[model samples]
Target: MASSIHDLARHLNISIGTVSRALNGRADVNADTRQRVLE
Candidate 1:
């Protein structure tokens, strides 16, 4: 699967690591951002 994690992180002003963890079902992701990313 090709994910836009880097782009999403940049637009959201967060780190790529955060985006990665979030998509992988980590507990540290911000709810709102995660939702947007998923969408």
Candidate 2:
């Protein structure tokens, strides 16, 4: 399991900001990307 946002972002091949945005449900994040982050 991912222990932190950094780990999750690395695993997902995305930036930390993207992960943060997705988790926070920011409008700028794409729907598919958000779903992947959520999962």
Candidate 3:
């Protein structure tokens, strides 16, 4: 099952907006950050 942005942020110890942007494929999110989320 996929986790929500809030769950991801808490799990990854990052900000919610950061997780949200990564998940939505926002340009603000770096490749490494996005890759971390995917993994």
Number of clashes recorded per candidate: 0, 0, 0
**Regarding lDDT, does 1 or 2 come out ahead?**
2
What are the per-model C-alpha RMSD values against the true structure?
A: 2.4, 1.3, 1.4
Better by TM-score, candidate 2 or 1: 2
Name the top TM-score candidate.
Answer: 2
C-alpha local distance difference test of each model: 0.82, 0.94, 0.87
> What digit string (tens of lDDT, one per residue) describes model 3 on residues 1-39?
968788888988889988888888899998998998878
lDDT of 3 at 11: 89
Q: Write the per-residue lDDT of candidate 2 for residues 1-39, one digit (tens) a residue.
A: 636999989999999999999999899999999999999
lDDT of 3: 0.87
TM-score of 2: 0.90
Return the TM-score for each candidate structure.
0.62, 0.90, 0.75
What is the overall TM-score of model 3 with all chains considered together? 0.75
Please state the error at residue 3 of candidate 2 in Å: 2.2
Candidate 2 residue 33 C-alpha distance from true site, Å = 0.4
